[model samples]
Target chain A: MTLNLEPLWLTLKLASLTTFVLLVIGTPIAWWLSQTRSRMKQVVATLVALPLVLPPTVLGFYLLLLLGPAGPIGKLTEALGLGTLPFTFPGLVVGSVIYSLPFLVQPAHNAFEAIGSRPLEVAATLRASPLDRFFSVALPLALPGLLSGGILAFAHTVGEFGVILMIGGNIPGETKVLSIAIYDHVESLEWTQAHWLAGGMVLFAFLVVLSMNLLGQRMRQIGQD
Target chain B: MIELDVAFRLDRGNFTLDVAFTAPGLGITGLFGRSGCGKTSILRCVAGLERAAGHCRLDGETWQDDAKGIFLKTHRRPIGYVFQEASLFAHLSVRDNLKYGMRRVPASEHQIAFDEVVDLLGIRQHLERAPSGLSGGERQRVSIARALLTSPRLLLMDEPLSALDHASKQDILPYLERLHDTLRIPVLYVSHAPDEVARLADRIVLMRDGQVQAIGSATEILSRLDLPLAQDTEASALIEGRVQSHDDNYDLTRVAIPGGTLTVGRLDQATESRIRLRIHARDVSIAIRKPETSSILNVLPARIVEMQEIDRSHLLVKLCTAGEPHPPLLARITRYSRDRLKLEPGQEVFAQVKAVALMD
Candidate 1:
């Protein structure tokens, strides 16, 4: 019920870090989805977007078991001297990354789809290796998609309460992100504290969306030529 | 010597592309065919853009062979392909588009100089601009220059000017002419337009339905009356000549054909330039004697080599000229004109050229 800024800052920090990590992993997946034709591509595509459509409650329930002391991931980490993953900030990051995955992937898929095969072909003839082509031509052209995906992932992760509560267990500084903090205020009938935290989140989300729209317009203009 | 015994099979619906050809070394060998005739597929196969069953050997180098397990990747093949569109990188400037190819080739072995290509294509002014800003003709010029900079053993161009309007095609043609003259590397030019083949190709490979229908000098196959395309309006004898002189004042350039000299609009080109002239079959009329009074400047006394009915109404007559030793000039006259003149096989006649289109 008390006004505490730590949970909000931790949530923001977690969302930012998770978004950065997801962009690295999501970029290649998006590019492959745009280019690959193999039978495995279908399976990979389904798996990447699976976390988006699956019920978050059910996924969180399963994650609770998977990261528990007796679970395989927990035991593996404990044996490796890292201890358990549950009730931790890193655990919330892992949960948020899985929950907000489709946000990162879909925008990038659309971006990669918009680029023509011409620049890549020109690159090949010019003696650019495939890696060079990806870095020099595909990555630069697909930047807008990446930017939008990263923003969506970060905003969605910041607002996530269900998965974080189920696995992270509302541990104060370690796991109580802003959304969990607002929910705690509501549970205790602390209207004033909830209003301030919720209002800040609303303002942050608006700015992100507005800036994202501008970024998309700039990217679309660059893509047109 | 550049040798190609390449054959590839491609299936598209009911249409199957089964093409094979062997090209002589040097200059340009045109892959001539109609739409959907697998001309582009053949070029793609040569460039390793498409995989085919057949093997290709160029100057004893293996580009593809299913049995030998040698199929170079598209990027690994030392080839330059100019697609129907310029296909230039829209994001890169013209200079970068050119650099795409040049940078790939090692500096020690690169035969094409950067400045030379820029000058050759007349793209120096446009180098800083992106491909989107360039005109269709300008884009194509850059495409040609990009391909040239690759230092390819074989260059493949698939209908590079098909997207352009007539004015653009005209503007792009002279650059191709210059490229054909300066580059000793073999080029495979794919087009359905007979005029393009006549203008630039030293040798023509006529393809019909995924098969090699005819292969010889551009003049020989073009003059044949039996082929469906020979009945076309542009169908004529392709006469090879050396630029004897160009008169600026009169606005005419004289070219010495086998039987006699022909002149057309003056060309600003080097003297002794090899040029091809398309003498329309409909333009030539048969005469038993040299006419004393006539407007046509090109009239050569010749013997009829052969005659065949191209269709119900058109008759194709072949005439032997003095300078052209290999191929004969074909004159397509109406059957009505043929019966009236009593023009028969092996008959001596005076051939009058109505018009001649000189090609660089």
Candidate 2:
């Protein structure tokens, strides 16, 4: 049987979209977690990290309920003339973003925390307004951690299986990502196809982990210098 | 004028800082105190970095007024602050760090040019380099230059030299002296080093235990016998003088103080230029009569103003060389000498100087 690449293309698209969206939304959350002294900081941090420890199926089940037609978010979307999100590409994107959030946020949070408060205060004394300081000083200093976070988020999204299965289901072009396609091949006893996909995933995982280690070493060298 | 009347209390009541003083708007005003005496707290309050309950007015502009319920944030206040550490941005080059504040300031309010500050702090060669490549002294110079380029109305320095090594501190002091000589911005300098304050401060506000101990000219505060500074072993007296003439043959310069002139080691200053002399208490000796032939150079008639027992063995004697209004000279002599001369307040004697340090 000829191996179709539609599932691989779909998986790459979902992972890229999820990584982009997570970086945009996770940055401010990480910054707030690093800088705030409010009582709710721990609560917010725990909520962001919930996807890290919860079983993927459990998380996926809750996400399904929340995005289904009868749920609150589903109802709001319907009221706004947008259809409910379940077994759709958008639903898969949402699930992947939540599942991969901690991968992005933790590194970014640590990076922002490592900067301390002195540079920001110095910027303030130099008459840099709040937004100017954030963009000019804080962002540049935290770029390494953010890049690592984005990479981790993308890698983690690509490997996710249970959450995608629960929320996205098996739509060939829309939600049949690589992990689901590999599972389908194994269920039908298509050993050759499964081996090809599984071997590619192993190589991808190794490359991602190796690059993260290299990036971490580079970050440490920059810190020492 | 810079006016600060602030009261700050930390949580758990472990520390409280209450101080009120006004300093001239022209020269450096040193906040001299020991560590934990709240000098840095006062500077932070003036910069709007630390919130305190009081009012701060800088050159007629109100920075904070609690009674009026107005508190200006730090970025809104036109003040430059040099922290104890050289906190330059790690990601920006020296040029970009200097321009960080200069770019934010409007052109109409730009009083200090970028090139002028770069040359002032002597950081021209390092402009293209990153902060990490600089020595401690070079980094601090860039930090100062960065603050200056903002053209701030007030400059606040919180022990800017405290973090440097001895060699770095020496390297940076001349640059600081040049800044003082060339710039017109008022500075509030916080330092625990007495000699640093004595060399740089025109006026001083002494703090002890979170209270204002005294506020006066540096000369008065340094020489006051009752204050803690005079009782310390490093106590010295400051005297302003005009250069009279240089003795090329002896390699000596003659400086005319209030009532008498002193022949000191050769100086590079021109005739008629003002200079400051720092005469340590230990270097001064008292004599009942002037020695006719002696190797010592400076000897001037003075009357004993007051005497305080420094310890069981030493006595710190305050003397007036030019009478009232002129700063007094401190002589740390053995109690044996005081007894031998029968020294008493208002009695005439001679102060034989052993050394004089030139402070610019």
Candidate 3:
């Protein structure tokens, strides 16, 4: 039987979009967390990491309630001329971003924190403006951490199942991602299709984790050298 | 004229820094003190890197005035700082590191060109290499070159040579000496090494316990027998002079000091080149009568200026060559000799110097 590739495309799209958005928003948050001495830093960090420990369905449930017609975000979106996002692709993307946030932010935060204050201070004495220093010194040195964060976030988003189910249900091209598709195959007793998809996921997850370990090892070598 | 006037008070827990001093803008002004005495704090204040309650003015420009509530940030100030550890940007090549500051200044404001700075620092071969691969001395050279590329109005060096080994320090000393000879940028060098201060400083600010103990010309301050620098057993005086002539036959060189000429071992420098001679106190002996025959080759008529007791058995005497505008010299002798020769201030005597140390 010819397999429908719509779910795979949707999963890739969702993963790519979520990874991009998380990187854009997570970078500054991670940087702030790394540099701040304020008491509020731990509070903010805990909130970000809540997704890692909290059930994805719990986050998805809250997001579903918040994105429903009666909720504030839904009301605001409706007022802004956009309809409510309940079981749509946009709702799935929003759920994926929240679920995968900690994966992206923690690595970036650690990377930025690994760089102490000396490089920035040296840059300052050399007449580098604050923005210049961030772009030139901070970003280049923390590149490995940022890459790890992005890869983990992408992989985590692709493997997401419960969040998408709770927020988006399984609406074919609009919200049906790979994991939900695989679940649907197994529920219908399609054992062959389930095995094919499950095996693909296992291989993909293994490669991604291997690459992360390799990147970490390479960074450590560079640091020692 | 004074180029920098700094008065600051920084309170960081138990370590409090209260200092105020004025130093000339030309040549190197050394901030000499022991460790943790706030020498680096003063330098950080001058560089505008650290904010404390104080007033710092550079060449009549107010960098920070606590009374006026004005403090210029480090980037806005025209200053170049060399950190103790040679904190070069690891990501950038040597060329890019040097260009970081150069690009900040407009072309018209560039006093030293890139080629000139590279040649001066001898980092032309290291341009494309990353800082991680360079030796300690090479890294420091690049750091200095990077600071110079900024065309800074003031250069602040915080023990730039302290982190290196003796060989690396020796490797960088000539380049530093060349920098001193070529650049007009006023250098505020922080160092705990007395040799560095004596060799490079035009003026010295003696610091102890976060306070300015003394500030004056290098020769005047270093020769003060009352200060800790001169009170030590290794205390010596810096005598500025020029090479009068080099006698190849006797393998000796005669240096022209303010009062008279000094004959020393052979020197490689040509005649008329300036030289600094270090005269240790212990090498000098005072005699009431001039000795006609003695193994000592250098002896000059000197009048005692001041005599102070160094210890129970020994005395330190300040002497001036018996001539107009005489430079000061130190003679460390026994207290018994003082009573036997009836040595007193203003008494004409001969100072027999056994040996003079030439500073390379």
Candidate 4:
């Protein structure tokens, strides 16, 4: 049986885009969560982490409604001449980002937390502005955390099945991610095709996780030295 | 001269920091106090790192005025603060750490040269190494170099030697002295070590329970019998003098004080260089008359300025050299000696200094 490469390409694309978006959006939120003492910090943190435990379809159902024609985001997109997001590649990206939010944020938050406030204060005393301190001191110090978080988010997005199915459906090039394509092959008793894709995913995931652990160890060694 | 007027009140849980003082910004003005006495808080206030309900003016420039709603943030204030810990940027090399402050200010405002600071701190060898690779002393030296490169209007050092071991402290102290002697910017040094304060500070501001207990020249405050520091067993006086001459054969040095010369152990400093002598009260013995043939090296005619009973058994005597306006010296003698010699406040006597310890 000829293996369809479209799902693998789509999965990789979705994972890369989702990881990028998550990093861009999760950084400041994680920083704020780590630094803030306000009561609202807990509320926001819980909301971000809710995706980690909630069923993928439950979150996908809500996101689907939000991206539908009657939804506010859908209405805004229509007004902007971009049209609705359902069943689109962009919809898959958004759904994957939300589905993988905690994976990206928790590690980054822990990284920022472990840094404490002394370095920032030291930077301030050295005449660094707030933005300068964040980029120069905070960012470099929290790099290990950001790396781990980005990797986890990327891996999670590559394997995401339920959320993509509910939001973007199994459209071939648009949102037929690896997991969903695997499911289709299993249902059709295409064991050879299923074995190819499923085994590939397991190996890829194991390698990603092993490399993350190795990178973490290497980062710790560098930090200690 | 830079002048400072700091009045602040910060209510922390069980402790309330209420402090007000004014000092001329010159050679090191030591904020001498016990731990948790709000000394660091005051330094932090001057740096604009801590916001308190009061006003602070440095060199006539207003840094914080709660009533006027003027509070400059820490980065906006031109200050070089050296914390107790080195607090170096772990990610940056020593050279980058030094340059961090340099890049912030304009080139025209750079009063301290990068090379000069590195030389003064003796960190030229470690310029390319990361902070984590440095020893405690090296890290602090680099941190100090970084602060100096800022060319701050005021240098605030909060127990800069507190975190180091004895060897590291010894290693870093000369560089601190170099900064003290060369830098024109006023330094506010916070420390609880009396010797550290005495050796470095030109002035001392004593704090207790968040209150300014006393403020005066280091010599005056360290010698005052009425202050708690003077009541200690190691109570001594700080006498500023210059290296008069060196006797290399005998390893002896003659230091000229206000009215007389004191022969101390040989020092490595150049002739005419100003040095501070710490004459412990217990090491000095009051004589009724000048001795003719005695092994005691230093004996100068001193007039009794004041005498107080330290305890039932001991007498604390304050004396000044007979004809010069030098710092007063302290002599702790037994009450029996005071009574037998009939020592009075107006009497002229001789102070036989058994030993004079060199400070810096």
**Candidate 1 local Cα displacement, residue A165, angstroms:** 1.2
* Residue-level error in angstroms, candidate 3, position B302: 3.6
What's the lDDT of the predicted structure labeled candidate 2? 0.91
Ordered from best to worst DockQ, the candidate numbers read 2, 4, 3, 1
Per-residue lDDT of candidate 2, residues B219-335 (tens digit): 999999988889878899999899999999989999999888999999999999998899999999999989888888899889899999999999999999963456689999999
Candidate with top TM-score is 2
Clashing pairs in 2: none
Inter-residue clash pairs, candidate 3: none
Residue range B1-360, candidate 4, lDDT tens digits: 778888999998888889888877778999998999999999988888788899999878998998889999999999999999999988888899999988999999999898988888889999998888899999999888899899998899999999999999989888888788899888999998886887788899999998899999988998887886687777889888999899989999999999889998889889999988898999999999999889998999999998888899998999988656757999999999999999999899999999888776
Query: Model 4, B113: alpha-carbon shift in Å?
Result: 0.9
Candidate 2 lDDT tens digits, A1-225: 889899999999999999999999999999999889999999999999999999999999999899899999999888998898889999999999999999999999999999999999999999888888889988999999999999999999999999999999999999999999999999999989999999999999999999999999999987886
Off by over 4 Å in 2: B1-12
Please write out the lDDT profile of model 1 over residues B1-360, one tens digit for every residue: 676668888877877887777887788898998897888889888877677788887888898989989998778888888989898876678898888778878888698899999999999999898798888999999998998898888888888988999999999898898898898888899999987887888788888888778888777777776675577777778777878898888888887666677777777667888767778888888888889899777888788888888779988888887554744778878899888888887788888888887666
lDDT of 4: 0.90
Error of 2 at B103 (Å): 0.6
Q: Candidate 1 regions off by >4 Å?
A: A1-3, B11-13, B244-253, B265-274, B308-313, B322-326
* lDDT, residue A200, candidate 3: 89
lDDT of 3 by residue, B104-221 (tens): 8889999998999999999999999998899999999999999999999899999999999999998998899889889887999999988788778889999998888999988888
